[model samples]
Target chain A: MMYIIVLAFYLLFTIWSSVKSLKNTESISDFTTGGHRMGLLLGIGTTTATWVSVASVLGVPGYLYSSGVAAIIGWVAGWCLGGALIPLVAYKIRRPETPVRTFPEFIHLRYEPYKQNSPLRMIVGILMTIGYFLLVHIQVVGFGIVFETITGIDYKIAIFAFLIFLLFTSIGGFWSVAATDTLNTVLIVIGVVLGSGAVLAATGGLQNIVDTLSTTTAPTIAGGPPLEQGILLSPLGTFSLSALISIFISNSLGSPASPHWVTRMLAPKNIKVAILQIMGTIGVLLFIMGPLIILGLGAKALLPSLPAGKTTDYIVPLIIQDYAPPLVGAMTLVALCAAAVSTANSMLLTAGTTLYYDVYLGIFSKKVSDKDFNKRLRLIIFVLGFLAVISAIKPPWFLAMGFVYVYGGFGAAFFLAVFLGLYWKRMNAAGAYAGILIGSVGYVVSKAMGASNPFLIAAGISLIGVILAVYTTKKPPIEAYEPYFEEKVSKSTDRVLSSVINRSEGA
Target chain B: MVTALLIWLGTMIFSFVLGTYLCMRIEKSGVKRWGATGKIFKYK
Candidate 1:
């Protein structure tokens, strides 16, 4: 009863925020990026909320409960390094003069500005659409777990129910997503912090938790073999040193190349706000991760092992149900829901925007009016959300570990291209294409061959591809690279890029 | 145990501070090439 009531109030708040945001969402710019005027507080809120997906909420805790200290090094420290690397991109990407609606559009302008329908843009849009679609599916799978636990509804029905909120929030686009994310960030912090405090109290403290971890021979989850005693406290718990290093590199290096993070960087008002937003988000996320570490380690001491048939994913909800006070449990579960929805809506929006704006408008028809485009974009998001719900009902085995594959692939594909495009004056469309194609293909093949670090290898291949292609191809026109490298672009260059720069000029 | 925890917490703070400083340098330096170019349009 308490869980249902809490969820109901949270749902009501999100719906209210979504409907309210609709008034300000007039153009495609407004729909896609909140008119590129997102302030620092809202920027930090949405970025943090979006960054802390169901993966971070559920998966991170589960990983820690199972694997121990290595999970912290791989995920927490790795992602922090990724956050640190983003400012390099943010400084160039968020120029007030070069406003962009989507990551594909940004790529289009940076590399192939002269072409009407660049294949580079199309390729990026297609990849983003596919990646985000899978991300939405992952979030829905998470929602199924939480909703089923609370409502006793069947998993399929609970997931379908999730689509209603996903559509409602996403239909309002960036403003609605950002607004709800702000509120969700607060909830996540409160829930995690309070839950951590309760877990620490229940386990008697950090010392006890650490001691138990160092001494226990308990299996991480139900029906699993027991780990070697003292392994949990080791630097490389269960994971070999090479595997640990690969996880670290994949998370840190691969994260900066992700389109969603790049899109968030573009939404902020200016370069300073963009840079500060990344810094602020890193700080807040560090705070959140601290409590989660406590919750995961402490839960081990509190519940030495889960019951039969329960996965490590059950650890969090189990801790809430068995150990914490009723109010804290309710709030923490709600926070998990918040994390799922926040990420789902953002991914849905990204996929839809790529399809509607980049693929549809950029390729087949370039003459869409603002009104018609907005309507069509909402429809695309609705359809995509519907598809995600259906897919989650029975996820394919291939999609099980897609988070790592997608992140590493994205890193390999876009790492060199994005960095060089920003700073290298001579990087041409050919180089960009080579980097994306070779990098993505290399990563996929390496993964197929079970390479220790596919991301690192693929990234290396991508660099060589980029270098060869850049040298062989004709240099990019002055107009193409000037806006990114120069604070003051030439008058002619500005005139050439006017159509690309201020996309919402006459809308 | 303490070392791992310290590494985790310490790395996060150091990364943020380093990232911020780099961004400040970029902002402070601005872009130098465009100054020599004639008839340029400055962005805010």
Candidate 2:
């Protein structure tokens, strides 16, 4: 009953937000970053929503169940380091580039300022779209899977429901999504805290859990792998720490490349990002990592019969079934829906923005005004939402579970290309193009060849692209991009431009 | 009962109070510039 009431109230609140955004939001900045008038709470809320996903919800639980605390440390570390990096990245992103809206726009401004067709950037944009598309698809499928597990609904129906629920999002794209996400994050936190409390209480409290573990009188089975790996929560972990290390590097740099992360730049928080990072760290720790730990503890107690390599990935739902009443169970399901929707919203916006701003404007639609862009953006959102629903009818479990494929393909292609493009002015566009092409092709080839770790294979190919970029052509001299990619990173930030905060979008 | 009592006591006096105090302080001053009705609630 509590869950149902909360969700019903949540729906009403979201409707109110959508109405509010429709009235106020008119231009691109208004749509993209709440017209740059967003306070810190909304900024932190979007950051939390971006940072938490099935990666924490289902991935960490399954990982803990299978491997122990070891596997989780690999993935969660990226988010932790990002807490420190977000300020520096946000500070760099907040200004001068305020006019520069999208991630691809940043690339176009910084590297290809000559404003000519560079095969490399087109490749960069296309490869990233492919990567982000897969990410969007995976989140939609994740919603289907968990909703299926929790509600006993068919997977097809579950996908349709998630898509329909998301159709309630603001028509202005990123603006509506961010506003909705900020409000929704409140419930996500509530569900995590309450769910954790219930599970801990039902399992006879922390003392009882500790006692249960200590009293497991069964002697060790020699030479056999530990039972925790079944849950992906083992002590040392399963995958090579190499996999862990690469994932961290790939994600930290890769995040800034995603248009989703860059859009937050437009919304200037009152606290500047330095403090927001610490708060963001708290948000992820509480909303994401904290729950995984709770779920881990619950799985250790609730599902003792979990077999080798088959830890309870569905730990939270099972606990809800055993612990909470019907309404709470249903509402927590909404929280899961929110997590997946928040993730999908960002990915969909990234792909649509890339298509419209990067590819369409000045080409298909020549006289592109701010008004025209708004119309195109809404059309893209509805079309993308429809495609996601259609594709998620039957999702591959491996991809839906969040590992290996998209991470490897786009992870290798974009991270290396974007970092090189930004930091290395001498980087030839050809090399950047070759890198993305080789990296994406390597992903397909590895899968075709039945390689064990296709992601690593793609990473190797990306490295080959970098080497080619270096050796095949001479680096563009420093003067080539000096006008745009400045040598000294600035410290004097938006405080000088404080007056421009509210007026940036219109004036 | 003893452990629970001690844990509850320590939490109430320390983490809970400190966290609230710090949060309130930040909202009042740290984000006064953002200017949201009266106090900004310091979450930034």
Candidate 3:
């Protein structure tokens, strides 16, 4: 009965937030960028919420439970470094003169320079769409797992429920996503922090956890080794140093290149808001990851046995269902669902917007009004969301591996170009194209061949491609690079200041 | 065991502080610069 009430409240809150945001959304810009007037608090809240996806909430903890502190160093430490690096890109990418709604559009404007048509732009756009689609699919899979665990429903039915929920939330665009994401962030913090506290208290505290896990052997799943004593406490417990370093680099460098996160960087009102958003994301991550680590370790100690065929991903849900009070268990379940929905909505929105603006409009449509474009974007959102739900019905793998594939793929393909294109004047269209092509192809070939570090190998090849192409190709003209680097005070700033002052005087 | 716990806690705290400080510095560097207020919202 308590579970039913909590689920009902979740549904009601989602609907209310979507409806309120729908009224505020007017044009494609409003839908895609939230009118570019988001304050620091809302900006930070949404970004953090979006970043803390099902992968972080569920997958990270599970990884910690199974693999020990190595997971923490790879995910938690690496992600903090990644979040901190966002400011370097946020301010420059969100520069007022070349206000781009999507990351692919930025690529076109930056790389193609004088040309109205660039295949490079189209390729990047398509790649971003594909990456985001895979990302949304993972979220849907997570939703199915959580829903099935909590409600005892078939996975297929849970997926349909998830699709319906996200469709309504995404229809209102960035406004709805940001508003609901902020609310979800608050709920997630409460759920994880309280859940951790409950688990710790039940397990008899920190010292007890350390003692219990020290002697306890972790469950063997899918033919993996059992966790021996002292492995969970060591920094590089089971993983090699090279593997840990690779994981850290891939996560830190690849994250900012993600379309959903890039969209968040573009939504804030000003550079200051963007910085605040990054900082807020860091704070939330630290808060969430800290307690989650404790909870995961506690689970490893307390629930050492899993039924046959069950994976570590089942640990958190199992603990909550079996141990916690009905109310707390229901709330935690709701929080996990919220995490999945927030991420899926953002990914779907980014994919839909990229398709509409970059592919449909940039290549096919001659003239599209803002209203019509927004209508098309909404349609694309529904289409993409439905497709994701269908694909998620038969997930490729467990959540962690699925996430790694997409994240690593994106990092290998786009990280070098994004970082160098912004800072290196010598980086030309040839270099950008070559880097993307080589990086993507190398990653695919290496993964197919079962290379141990496909991501790192692909990234190395991409970097070489970038260097060779830059040296061989002709450099872009000064005008092509000016927009990104120039810091001259434009007339627009003067007008904004005058307008603010006039409004104050009139008041 | 105590040392390991202290190391883990210390790393998390350091990350949080360092991240916050870097972001603050980035924001401060942008003050008074053009485009610091970001793009104008033409569409309301």
Specify the highest-lDDT model's number.
1
Listed models, DockQ each: 0.25, 0.07, 0.18
On residues A1-507, what C-alpha lDDT tens digit does candidate 1 reach at each position?
Answer: 788889899999999999999888887788888888888899999999998887777777777888888778877887788888887787777653757778988888888877767789989999889889988998998888777765577889999989988988999989999999999999999989988999998998888998999999898766689889988888888888888888778878878888888888788776667777888898899668888888878888988888886666667777877888878888988888898999999999999999988887777746666777778889999999999999899755222135666778888988888888888999989999999999989998999999998999999988988999999989999988888776778887777676664443343
Q: Ignoring the other chain, what TM-score does chain B have in each prediction?
A: 0.58, 0.46, 0.60
Error of 2 at A124 (Å): 3.0
Top-scoring candidate (DockQ): 1
Least accurate 10 contiguous residues by lDDT in model 3 chain A = A498-507
Candidate 2 residue lDDT tens string, A1-507: 454466567667777776676776677766666656666556668767766676566666655544445544444554454344444334334434333556665555444444444344455566656666777777777777677766677878878877655665636466677788876576667666666677687787766654544433221122344443232333334556565555554444445444555556556653243245344535445555666566655655665544333224565666676786666666666677677777777777777766665666523424445677677777876787778789777664543235445555555565555556545666766666666678778867976797656666776777777777767887654433342344232333222222222222222
- DockQ for the candidate 1 complex? 0.25
Order the candidate numbers by lDDT, best to worst: 1, 3, 2
Ranking by DockQ: 1, 3, 2
Best by TM-score: 1
Docking outcome class, model 2: incorrect
What Cα-based lDDT does every candidate model obtain?
A: 0.81, 0.57, 0.75
Candidate 2 chain A, run of 10 with poorest lDDT: A495-504
Candidate 3 DockQ, CA atoms:
0.18
**Against the true structure, candidate 2 has what lDDT?**
0.57
Native contact share for candidate 1:
0.38
User: Of the candidates numbered 1 and 3, which has the greater DockQ value?
Assistant: 1
